[model samples]
Target: MKTINNSSKALLATMLTVLAMAFSTTTQADGHAKPGDFTRGANVWRDNCGRCHNIRDARELRDDQWYSTAFHMRMRGGLTGQETRDVIAFLTSSNKPARKPIITDAKAPTASSKASKLSGKAVYNQTCIACHGADGKGTLPGAPDFSSAKGPLSQTDDILVKHVTDGFQSPGSPMAMPAKGGNTALTDADIRAVVKYLRSFSK
Candidate 1:
């Protein structure tokens, strides 16, 4: 009787341990994309996704595309489920169509005024400064050395804009330049402004 009781207790303990481990694994597998996940996702994106290429705008892809891309990137970037989910949330939100301006009939700034207000430095600071240093010297391993005359900054405005608008992976380099610097909010003019800002580094 004593032996049987001991055996039973040991079995129960083992069973409990196994159950706890199973629960933990399951929890990790199905991560929650709770509120504010996008904010976390942005950090993950900056840390992991930015290493390879320009952090593409989240709006560049569709909902399903974001899901698939996140999955693919999860394996590539070795991202956890929670991180992947957060990135998906951020990307999907960015992809949503822009809402039309409200018809409040209130006075609005003129197009020229709005255009004039768009500063190249502002766009660079907001978007490009994350990977590229303030001096355009580059903060990452493969980032172009804008301060170097032989660097990518030597490229023409059209080429620079194209690279800025679309991702570019240079030969013999492990890192990549992400399209639009991962900020989907930037317009074509914004990209042009950033390109102009980059040119200032070469002069």
Candidate 2:
């Protein structure tokens, strides 16, 4: 009984040590997030992080702590690249002291600029690749295959865009695509870019 107890305690200590090391490594690896990804991160937090716990207020952690915690959670949650950056952005941005925005009267971009600025492939990779797949052949069981002639891409651009923006449950499919592909930060142009990317597979 004494030997058994010692073994159990040793195992527990080893596990704890490994965990601490992992956390430390993750914190260091995450570093600081760049700006502009905060809105995307907010959406990621709501969609993914909310699954396990009440969405903690981002202000709950200081900047350094947020980086560590977000990085740790990212490893556990399987977030990568921009998704991780975005979450960190959301947390760190929220940690800032709140203040009213300085308003400036500026005209919106012209149509040509908006069209050129967004990349369909980048948007698709960031938002849709999780479910829809890197090959346009969905990871989810019922995710529509963009490469298929009779798939979602077969629909008119208007119909596809509407379905994507508003979210869609295929007629007989088990999984439902989330609204704005779960990234509410995505602009209308972003959605169109994703659609264009998907359509590329058909060509």
Candidate 3:
């Protein structure tokens, strides 16, 4: 059995990208399509996509465009139908433009005041787990280790939530985490939940 080298993998990824672009310019909706889990898709993406090349920024494509591209990738990457759907979910969800909170309600929870209906662990699994890993030690290079006493998790909740909301690049990380971990749908409360959850990693 012969193993393909990194250069071979890189070449393959490039070819796949070219093929994807050639595959379609129009969005085709599938009525029977099953929605993929964003978090699972993130895990699939992190664990697999980088094997071929540097991961493309999710913001580079429209959600509809991602559907076609993800399908193309599915064929080339030998991803399962479910995995393909998951990747599509991850791509489409991760790419949306960030929306700032419009607080018209006088009773809205302030950023400084913490409240969340979603559990911190739930938020972490959904948004933060892809890069941060389940252990909080990080799955990507330069991702902060949550278990470290002096790491990002040790920061105050206010700082952590702000960072999650605004996005941040670690000193040596090859890539920066997108705001709200690329889930613009996440609320201030969700960020706070994940932040609080992540803190437990250090303790």
By summed lDDT, which 10 consecutive residues of candidate 2 come out lowest? Answer: 97-106
User: Once model 3 is optimally superposed onto the true structure by TM-score, how far is the C-alpha of residue 86 displaced, in angstroms?
Assistant: 1.4
Tell me which residue pairs clash in candidate 2. Answer: none
TM-score of every candidate relative to the true structure: 0.50, 0.53, 0.73
Model 3 C-alpha lDDT per residue in residues 34-81, reported as the tens digit of each score: 678888898888988888977777777898899899888888888877
Which prediction has the highest lDDT against the true structure?
Answer: 3
Clashing pairs in 3: none
Candidate 2 lDDT, tens digit per residue, 1-203? 43558889999999999898777753343334344375577567757875776556554678789777877887888887567778876666555542222542244443423553669988886777756767988655566788886877888888988887777777766545656665556666787777877889888
- Strongest candidate by TM-score: 3
Q: Give the TM-score comparing model 2 with the true structure, all chains together.
A: 0.53
Off by over 4 Å in 1: 1-43, 48-86, 89-117
lDDT of each: 0.70, 0.69, 0.80
Specify the poorest-scoring 10-residue window by lDDT in model 3: 25-34
Candidate 2 Cα deviation (angstroms), residue 43 = 13
Give lDDT: candidate 3, residue 56: 73
Please provide, for model 1 over 99-119, each residue's C-alpha lDDT reduced to its tens digit, 9 standing for 90 to 100: 334643256643422342568
What ranges in model 2 sit over 4 Å off?
1-116
